[model samples]
Target: MKIEGIVLIGIGAFMAVVSVGYWFWSGEPSGTAMLIGAVLLGLLPGGYYYWWAKRMKPRPEDRPDATTREGAGVIGSFPHGSIWPLVFGAGAFLFGLALAFGWWFLPPALGLMLVAATGVTTQSRRGGAI
Candidate 1:
């Protein structure tokens, strides 16, 4: 039903049909190609089943996606998100300054950048989580 499964099925069917056609038309080469095609067809269905089973199965909490209830859709935006953008800009400024000056300032500047990026990401996710 999923797109990946449909694609695999279509590919498998196509390969199988082509292989059969070749077998009737040609000789040893066709037989080799048929073997390869049949192998591919078998693997495709096997992979599809494996993925389906994985999706159908469930696990305990403590997984990153355990609490993810709904599909990933658009969430509400943070009204004050502009502040985070400015924070990121300041971090970039500091980073650039450190680069121009010396390597000694690089660590602090990188730390600032990391903090700014983390704050922005966390704030955005928190504001948007539904």
Candidate 2:
């Protein structure tokens, strides 16, 4: 993770330097903005990873002689299956159809989408399987 953070910071710095060059070459505002945006995109993740590495405790991989087996363990809980995804998909489809059809279809579609989202969010609290 430390190495990853260093690499990301390097990449971000490189992008920023390149953006400066681009701005010097072409004085166009849009192009300059894009270049600056690219620099920002790179820096955001780099900064996040760097901060995370500093804040979090070192993992097994941080050790010089750590083995692959040393890092092996259950990652986290994952849902086996759920019906909410299908409901969400249906709502999405309806929303898309509403856009192509009439205004009357919009309300119902939006309502369905809201309901589906709520169902998915509350399912776990209700002891429902994912």
TM-score of each: 0.36, 0.73
lDDT of each: 0.66, 0.80
lDDT of 1 by residue, 1-130 (tens): 3444656766776767777777677756847676667759755785776588567643323244655564355555646434656766777887888779877777777777788788877776767621
The TM-score obtained by model 2 is: 0.73
Give stretches of model 2 more than 4 Å off.
61-64, 67-69, 72-74, 124-130
- Top candidate when judged by lDDT against the true structure: 2
Model 2 has an lDDT value of 0.80
| Candidate 1 local lDDT, residue 14 | 70
| Per-residue alpha-carbon lDDT of candidate 2 for residues 13-76, written as tens digits (9 for 90 to 100) | 8878988888788777887798778777777888898899999977887888888998888755
